[model samples]
Target: MSVTLVLIDACAASPKESRVQGAVQAVPKTAVHRVVVQVNSDDPVIMKHAITNSLNLLKAYGDRNEAAAVEIVAYGAGVNMFREDTSPVKDLLRFLHATHPDVVFSACGNTIAIMERNEGHPLSLVDGARSVPFGVVRLVELQEAGWSYLRP
Candidate 1:
């Protein structure tokens, strides 16, 4: 199976990112094996969009006859999605965490620190997420490991 990675560098002004990710999930193409959504914005709205988009994508993947493994990696302001307390989109985040095993959510540690300082509390992640050192490096590593990159 081929792996398709969706790199979500933009949090604002892009429904295409979510739509493409959903499309890919619906098909479950052997041409695609893995899909990664990299979020690189700091805006709360952007983070919300990323999480919402990711959940939609995962739902599509689950409904497909075949599906690619999906990972949602958050960095910069996008890291706010993980913070346990400030998550306004808690229901959606929790739903994603509960339903999909192939769906992995990652929060960048460096971004977490910044978020905590700004938000005046410790950063939090959904129960199923892993904390990575850096988002860009993770993307590079995923790409070098043969994942196709799509900036949607």
Candidate 2:
């Protein structure tokens, strides 16, 4: 089964715009699929669009009954999505995680450290997330592991 990974690095917006630059990396799925979104900013608009696009992709898989995995990695200013106390979109984030069992979220440890410097404590992650050492490095590893990359 062929697997594809969506490597999201651009701040999310319309699926087309957010997905254009990274289109080359994605492989069509014959058996499995994965989508990884790397967030690098705190802009609500970007995050919202990213969330929507990821959902759209998931729906595509669900409709086809294709086996797939989805992940969201927040790095740099993107770590704000998982901030324990101050995230502006906590409710929606929670909803997405609970509803989507296959979706995993990762927060960059390095970004968390920086966030701590400003907020005074390491940020807690959302319910269904894992924290990683670095976002960019993880993306590279995912690609190397044969998961096609998408920059949406």
Candidate 3:
């Protein structure tokens, strides 16, 4: 149950910064399941389902006293789920982030740039959502790191 906080920069030259926060009992990697959930649709129901599935998986692992990590990555129209103003599930996202430190929300910088360009203003993201250079690249990296991928 070790809690690690990581700060990932979009730039490759900047090595991601990570820190072990409060120590919870640590679990071995083999015992922990890692998942990266992809969200690319603007449909609110799809967004809700993706989040619900991730939360359920985390809860199941916790119930068994096992460890699991869930990352929800958004790009294209799906990036709207992380936007403060347009997100239909902003409160739910914030609540999940507050309760589950093992869960991560990532917003694609490329998508955000396109959105901002269309809107002609900077968009605000929900709290706890991190920016990644590209969502597809992030997915590939996560899969290469042995995380199972899910798109709901």
Candidate 4:
């Protein structure tokens, strides 16, 4: 099985293939594009914008056969963006989960616990959304690790 998909440039020989004449450099998956996005608003408009940006990043990198990871960290009131019940953009979230393999939706574990306690029941996140211990800390860690930060 292939480790990852490679896109061959029809116009030029890839460097990975050979060192012959007119060889062009190949963009290996190892050169990953990373971005951490913050979404702390409960507004649907903001949530949609963040999701759109993530999709765009993934598409741009995918077109070049490069690896990309777009992480959306939802904390505070923004945690509602990932809630299965309260999210206004749950449809879009579900679509992304089904179609976009490179995009991640991260809910704050601390926020989740608080919300659950307030509601007196467990809260379910949108399909494919995962929980992190602390959203802000994760954001800081990602930025420290050289991931581009964006707030939308």
Candidate 5:
């Protein structure tokens, strides 16, 4: 399997700075706090940390998830996070999805595709887990759009 990678340069301009460079590059701040969390490990403990971190952020905003947009992007071995048959935290996933529309759970489509091909069958994501083209690219896009990045 090809390793997923995200190269974030410290010297690179932020979204705010990019806006000053050109209006077309500007991404408007839609929420007070925008966060994107990355999950690339298959470890259940790591996945739980990501969920807890997201809950903490939302709780800080009085459990008003809309006050802080949060997204969880999973890829690599972490794709198992959304695997319907193998997920260890499906209960929490269901609760969070039912209660928080602002917390988006994204599975990497590329990883899913590779897994399906290798297994010679299709896969099913747990309820409320959606697909993105690529986890690394999703994280990069969110950062570019001024979303705070977190990995747990």
Candidate 6:
């Protein structure tokens, strides 16, 4: 009896081709387009620009019928933008979140703790803002996941 060998690339083969001689094949999964925007400045104008850039990217992807996710991470003095009492763009942030629910705003928890210690009072964050353990760590994680990084 002669033996036969058939090589198959799971990613290149379809489901029908995956089953060969009672063997199942696996395929590589594709990732969605994602971006991370980093903000470390206390300037309202800089913060606004970063938000605008994220929005513009989302709009561009939407117009092309492609799905994209955006995450804005704030650390250091930039975390001020997420403070309910001190944020100059609180209304704009609310409006943006209302319009684009997919957009995410993340604040550095470490920064918040430091600020609270200095001020001797609890801090209030703007609605819809989430706190992560560390903003730089978050950025690093996002980058490792194949997300594009922007510091505008």
Top-scoring candidate (TM-score) = 3
Give one digit per residue, the lDDT tens place, for model 5 in 1-152: 22222221111112332221123322223457878899999998888888778767766655443356678899999999999988977876776676665467889999999999999999999987878888898889889877899998
lDDT of candidate 1 over 96-146, digit per residue (tens):
655554466778877777766876977557787767778777777667756
Give the alpha-carbon lDDT of every model: 0.58, 0.64, 0.75, 0.73, 0.74, 0.73
User: Highest lDDT: which candidate?
Assistant: 3
lDDT of 2 by residue, 1-152 (tens): 22233432222111111121233222233437766776778887677766776777776766667656666777888888777676666766776776664465777877787778987866677677667778888777666766656554
Backbone clashes in model 4: 0
**Regions of candidate 2 where Cα sits further than 4 Å from its true position:** 1-31
Across 1-152, the per-residue lDDT of candidate 6 in tens digits comes to 22222221111111212221244422112214677899999998888878778677766666665666777899999999999999977876876687665566889999999999999999999988878878998889778867799998
Compared with the true structure, what per-residue lDDT tens digits does model 4 show for residues 7-86? 22212112232111133312223436778899999988888888777777766776777767667999999999999889
Candidate 1 global Cα RMSD:
11.6
lDDT of 6: 0.73
Clashing pairs counted in every model: 9, 1, 1, 0, 0, 0
- Give stretches of model 1 more than 4 Å off: 1-31, 59-64, 114-122, 150-152
Better of 1 and 6 by lDDT: 6
Please provide the root mean square deviation of candidate 4 (C-alpha atoms, Å): 11.9
TM-scores of all models? 0.64, 0.73, 0.80, 0.77, 0.78, 0.78
Q: What tens-digit string does per-residue lDDT give for candidate 3 at 32-90?
A: 67788999999988888887787778767776766677789999999999999999878
Give the Å error, residue 82, model 4.
0.7
